[model samples]
Target: MAAVLLTGTGVTWTYVASGGHRFDVADAPDAPVAVVFGAETKTPYLTGRLETTIALVKAGKVRSVLVSGNAAGSSGNETRAMTSYLLTHGVPMAEVVVDPYGVDTYDTCARAVQVYGLRRALLVTQPYHLPRAVSLCRSLGMDADGVNAQCACGGVNLFVNEAREWFATVLALKNAIWHRAPGVASLPH
Candidate 1:
């Protein structure tokens, strides 16, 4: 048990450390696109990510925004909600790309490379998630940098997400090693 726990911790730390840097909006480097990972629609997680993508676009740090998420169906579609949010918040429709089958971090990164042909991207997510996201994208052959999205998030939910990242990081390492293609096809807009 001790070995297992320590291994998980080690993997998490190395995985995150491998991500290199996490930038703030003001200091983020230019990239071809800002890839916003999906979260529950209407929540602080989703809102913060979308807002950061908007900022990146407005600042001309990225030429486009790629909103990737699980849009499994018409009801509660994350891709639709994310696209709508960006369009309403001053990001022009022409500059927004949508990937409705992102479903998870690995899939999102895989699709970003395999489907969208992205050589570089700015990953936008919350602090707790940015490292894994950046690492996954980089491992999949994209030159990925990350920008942490600000959010008024806390309490049980934040705690849960932080704790969950330990396990998620391990999975990320495995996925990176395997280099499997994503299950779904490109649903880019």
Candidate 2:
């Protein structure tokens, strides 16, 4: 069982290896959309992802944007916040796609395809989390690549995110086999 898990880890890591850092937008390919993973309200990490997504649109690295995060209407309604921020920054409302049902990274990657109809995207998030984001998004067949949004955030939050990612990576591998959609998962909106 341990061997199987390690193999799964290796496979997941291999899948995500296709994505890497873009030192500048000049090195990045233009995509139909930049999918910014949702984070908590007003945190530097989330801010970094959103700002990078906005930059991608403004710079023409991407033509559209998808903000995937918790839209459950209780605490983590980040899609609205992200969309508003994008709009104020000059991205047209029509160009922003919001997924409020992205309960976590797994949900975001899976639902980005099942719900948003994305064929290809530039996955936007910080470096520590980008690998899993890329792997999960691609493994689910979304034609996904990733950009490590420039984030200066650190301290306990950063440490927590890094630690959480290890477990999340394993869960993402299982999710690859489960192939459960948010609609089927029945997570609250």
Q: What is the clash count for each candidate, in the order shown?
A: 0, 2
Q: Give the clashing pairs for model 2.
A: 71-100, 72-189
Q: Judging by TM-score against the true structure, name the best candidate.
A: 1
Q: Give the best candidate by lDDT.
A: 1
Candidate 1, which segments miss by more than 4 Å at Cα? Answer: 6-19, 73-75, 185-189
Q: How much does candidate 1 score in TM-score?
A: 0.90
83-142: candidate 1 lDDT, tens digit per residue: 999999998899989998898999999999999999989999998888888888888889
lDDT of 2 by residue, 52-153 (tens): 888788788898888888766445568888898899889998898878777688888888887778889898988778777887777788887788798879
Deviation from truth (RMSD, Å), model 2 = 3.1
TM-score of each: 0.90, 0.85
Computed on alpha carbons, the lDDT of every model, listed in order, comes to 0.86, 0.78
State model 1's lDDT.
0.86
